[model samples]
Target: MDPGFIGDGRTVAVAERSSLTFGVEEEFLLLDASSGVNLPVGDDVLARLTGQASEQSRHEFRQSMIEMVTPVCGDLQQMREHLAASRKAAGDAAAAIGAQLVAVGATPVAEAAVSRPAAERYERIIRQFGPVALDPALCGMHVHVGVPDRELAVQVCNHLRPWLPVVQALTVNSPFHAGADTGYASWRSIQMERWPSLGPSPYFASAAEYDDAVQQLITAGVMLDEGMVLWYARPSARYPTVEVRVADVLPTVDDAVVVAGLVRALVATVTDDIRAGLPAPRLRTSLLSAAHWRAARDGIEGQLVNPLTGVLSPAWELVDDLMSLVGPALTRDGDLQAVTAGIDRLRVEGSGAERQRRIHRAGGDLHDVLVYLAGATTGSVAR
Candidate 1:
């Protein structure tokens, strides 16, 4: 007999309105404080944060990476507070171990030996994926927004496909890899796309169709389990939420919050559209993947393939369109002002990748890049 379906009977609770509640998960590179090299100190950091008020810090695939998940937050402000507290606590722990937590998409230094975490699942990945499994020395931020039911969650994931590249463009913070500038805004995206499961999720007719595909992948041995989907967006395996996994770990806390708020507003907009009988866009997955590639290559500094028109246009113009698409939801959540201000600030200051390039051009080395990243991760600018 075939294995049982995992997401059966998941439609028991349908949310009539968007809860607008959300959370954020940020992954950070642990760096040696003195040398700015990637350091395998995540175990020490997790041990320090293990028995705190809540289980916030967790070990990622690589020992040089740590991840923190915030509690469910009602608004952008609450999300900011929780992220700030978590970053500080983790920073403190890392500092005690002669390491620093750096909010960067990829480490500038090459890893001589991949440091695998002690988890059996991680070991399995290492054994299965070879070099690609160790590629997550890069970091990213995932935003989780609540949905009422699995069906709606899957619909939101479908509706969210086209807009994901815009999200990636806004959060492209990785411009360097292996001790030199790779020139792409997010080299991490390039590294991650090596995995078969990573990219825009295909449209599904229903929640069952989605679950069936996941089970097929498991049965085929391409993935270990449902948790390995790693699509640009997916229904959270653990929570009643749709997780957006397209963004890099931004350099600043406020940037992270702005992205989270935008994602929440997008979900609200999509859910409302679905209720009004609007069908999700039927773009092909190959086109969606191409859009993501352009976004990662150019970030906000160059052209983006428009999700709606499929035309090459200025990245900022696409971002403006994105803002307009979710404007009503932002107004409903009272986050219009914060998100608008954040966009304005970002426009003036540029994406984190631009900022890193500027620092590197100013005669600063990779160690200097690490210092800047560490300071920005703590909500301050360092130059």
Candidate 2:
């Protein structure tokens, strides 16, 4: 079947392919409305959203953070609607307590101590990782795409390493922290590196090997459990999917959809390649690390290190290359147009980090950044 019918110069529908099914999990910062600083009110917000059917909001590792999980969706429209409704609900709940939910990657003016949930596992994390675990005031967006099985998920993750930095560049945010410009597009990305298990993982030969490695991390006390394997891309421990955790939580729901679509396409394309017996791309760990750092530093405004040759290229050109790489899968899933339009919008409006700097450069303070983030989170801004 045609992915979608183009009739009267309009696309009538998107594909209902099984490969299109995916879900998004986003984290947000809760801030005091009056002070524009991080507020440890996530428990209050989740309490308020307890009975809402819109979307489920949960407390994260920090009391100042809230997370939203979208039900598995088959199309970009469904994902967007779910995220939008959830953000609105969370915003309303926060407002009820004189706070606001800001869709930002990190709190610009706060580094409060970690206020973990009541779960014993969370308490274990604080005990194990100590100050490093408490240093993260970061919010991130995680995209999970359905995979056929564990082996395929492992292979896809192996093949996904080199591309992870590019993904971060596309979704970079959290440029400012501690009430000042941090000189990095995604400061949250930098912050997360403090965790030992974070970043791209090595190529695993099979599912067994991957599981063994995670077990080793647990046995050695590097992490507490499978849930703490926090690679940029990993097979979800609790879900039958591959979760890409490279992106910072974007301010707008539309941008989140775009990133999620790209993630799904990447998984599908890599899975097909692995099945076809194509060799996974290999790059030195040093090069991959540099690439990730460069992506975090400049986002799309500067150069990105080429994964193949370790050469720096214009970020936009490299992004075009990524689009080309995932083009076939995107077209097959009927997400080509949506993804294209989304990238174009991002180019014009800039990534969340860029937008934040734009506001800050105009003499707007951190409070202004919070207000702008709130507006963007609710889709009130044009972009």
How many clashing residue pairs, candidate 1? 1
Candidate 1 has a TM-score of 0.93
Note the Cα lDDT for every prediction shown: 0.83, 0.82
lDDT of 2 by residue, 1-383 (tens): 01121111222111124354678889999887767678888888888885543346666888899898887677788888988898888888888998888888877887465576788888788888888877857899999877637788898898998888889998998998888888999999898989999887778899999989899989999888898989988888876678899999998988899999998898888887887999898779889989999999999888999878889999898889889999999998889999999998887888889998998888767778778888888676645
Q: Stretches of candidate 1 above 4 Å error?
A: 1-19, 50-54, 380-383
Residue 319, candidate 2: Cα error in Å is: 0.6
Q: Which residue window of length 10 is worst by lDDT in model 2? A: 1-10
Tens digit per residue, CA lDDT, model 1, 161-254: 8899999999999999878899799999998888878888889989999999999998887789999999999998887788999999999898
**Model 2 steric clash pairs:** none
lDDT of 1: 0.83
Q: Model 2 misses residue 371 by how many Å?
A: 0.7
* RMSD (CA, Å), each prediction: 4.1, 5.5
